[model samples]
Target: MRHRAGIVTDEMLTIPKWRFAVIGMLEALGVVTGMYSAAMLPGPAIPILNQTFLLWQLGFSALLLGRRYSWNKIAGCLFVAAGVVTAIASGSESGQMLSGVGLLWPIMMVVSSAFQAGATIIKESVFIDAVAHLKGKLLDIFVVNSFGSAFQAFFVLLFLPVLSNLKGIPFHELPSYIKSGAGCFFNVGASSGCDGSPLLPLLYIVNNIAFNISILNLVKISSAVVSSLAVVLSVPTTIYILSLPLPFLPEGVTLSSYFLFGSVILVLGLILYNVPQHNNIKHNSDSDFM
Candidate 1:
């Protein structure tokens, strides 16, 4: 149907091959490292670390894309980081801080955010840079996504041996481990650890794919910073959901008493970031008059 509809454009085809390869490689590193580090970090730490990507995104967009922001946007990013940290810290148990073997993982997570942010900025640049050559036509999201995914798969294959060994699995034993995982995913294996089985995993995969596509589309339509902001908005929602009583999950936990206070600060930061400043409005009015 896509072929019949001609969604693939000549403009998309004109994008440089190296661009896609770069995006794929960077994003692959980010995903692999991020997942590994996340597996090691405490649950409460995940949201806090994940939100740090907004800082990385802002930095990369400024450096790579040569974009400037108002002070409000910058403060908004900091508020977001502070809010998530405050909220997560409220529920954290004593001795839950990253230390010992866990210390390196937190650093890796931050570095992973750098990689992801760099890739996202590059992706945005692909759209921005293409506008001139394509005569204002934007590149197709699928074209970027498909090539990036293919390259990411290649990199993931290359990283598998090292990744497995780092996780304490022998390289030779990795195949069996993956096979056992597949079996468990299908619910046909003898392993009793497969609780939700194929259904839950499949649903998770579907939802994740949709979420990623939406993020990419958002990046294409707006700036990389905006897309990162959208992702940041989800942190509070995730924390709230985690506190809810839900089936197929452990007993729900409550948010820390500080959650409301942090949330208010977060909301204020968001409002400040999004609402146009008086100077900006005056400038826009002057431009219109001229």
Candidate 2:
């Protein structure tokens, strides 16, 4: 559509400033906090965080978009949540209790999830409004993402003081932190002798960028709740992948039989959640033909 409309210019690549100021800032905070929390926390806590994200997305979608959920959808979400909890609980490293400082990280993750949900719903709402005004112009996902990511980077810098404090870095040492980060990025200085393959961080950056793009596209096509659900559905796949014996791992991790059972339940729940929407689409198609 953009090509046909000849709207592929630099101006077309920009999201509205107001929307970026609001939604983009929230998304940046969410992305930064979510990544920071995960790095500081343990693997077991991630499932709980994912559940928190799902619930928050549902709530945000409902409030922001006036979206209604059917009994099946609710049940499906609950089942997926339960399945993830069960799988993670069974597979998490033994004896690492979530107490004291551990508990704080999960709470932070939940807060991050809430910010993400809010950003997603707001972006979706903006897309909807833009589509309504489409006279011959295209609604470009890249445009929204470009502006949103720019604002996100700005907010990340703005919150550096708080993040630095959380990391126990003195405010005066902020320059040193940046220099150290740059050194690590280029495999130079003190971080040059790190044992891990340099490809790991490169892969992570690629994955994170792709993930943001996917989330934005998902929000554009559907509601934030559905995007969250799509992520919820990936839990099992992630668990299974982790179970593999990769070179980075000291040993092959074994998953409990319960993980398989939970995986099945998660798939079933996702199918249930989509049943109503699928039927509605099919019904509308039949009516069109009739």
Candidate 3:
């Protein structure tokens, strides 16, 4: 069907191979390092570190794309950082406060996120200044995502031995681990057995897919920094959900005053990030082409 629609033609398949290769390699590294960092860090710390990527993205975008930011945008970025820091500082689990292992973990996550943001910005730049017949056609986010994901899977598989060893799994057990994972994925092995309701995994899978799609769409319509800001704005929503009496959560989960204040500040930051001046600038640029 894709072939009939010219979507899978030989012409479409032929692109500047080096561009795709570079993007794919960065994406692969990002995925591997992100997984490693997530394994090493605490859950709450992960979001805080992930949110820091907004700064990296903004800086790199300006440097690489010569993107200009309004003063409001800069203020918004600062507010986001302050809000995240406030929430983290006031939490009960904030004892480490970037000391010892805590410092290392967040740094690793930030590096990983920088790779991801770099890939995002490069892809967006390609779309903004496309060449030849590939101008609009190659800008498809789905195509970019499919290629990036394929490359990520290949790299992950290539590094399986290293990753397994890092996790303290024996080399000989790697095959069994792969087999068990495949079996569990297919729901045909002992590993498939779940202690809780089956609906949980299904819901998780659904949510994961939806979340990925939403993020990719955001990156397509806007810049990487905006996409990161959108994710940052969701921190409060995640906190609220965790505070609820969920089935898997322990009882007595509650939000602190600092967290609430930080959430409010984060929302304001989001609003500032989308100030009318930004839209006006974008509108004027589009009108130039028209």
User: Could you tell me every candidate's TM-score relative to the true structure?
Assistant: 0.90, 0.83, 0.82
Candidate 1 per-residue lDDT over residues 1-290, each given as its tens digit: 45357877766676788988888889889989899998988777777777878899888776776666777778877887787677667755636466555578988998899888888988888887878878888777887788888888888888998888888999999889888988999998538888888999999999998998898888888777777777777777777897788778668976767887777777777776776656653321211100
The root-mean-square deviation over C-alpha atoms between each candidate and the true structure, in angstroms, is 3.7, 4.5, 3.9
How well is each residue in 201-230 modelled by candidate 3, as lDDT tens digits? 678888987886678767767767777777
> What C-alpha root-mean-square deviation, in Å, does candidate 3 show against the real structure?
3.9
- Alpha-carbon local distance difference test for all models: 0.78, 0.72, 0.71
Q: How do all the candidates rank in terms of lDDT, highest first?
A: 1, 2, 3
> Which run of 10 residues does model 2 get worst, by summed lDDT?
281-290
Model 1: lDDT equals: 0.78
Write the number of the candidate with greater lDDT, choosing between 2 and 3.
2
Q: Which stretches of candidate 1 lie over 4 Å from their true place?
A: 93-96, 99-102, 278-290
Which segments of candidate 3 are over 4 A away from where they belong? 1-12, 88-90, 93-95, 98-103, 135-138, 183-193, 196-199, 250-252, 278-290
**Which is the better candidate, 1 or 3, if ranked by TM-score?**
1
Clashes of each: 0, 0, 0
User: What TM-score quantifies how close candidate 3 is to the native fold?
Assistant: 0.82
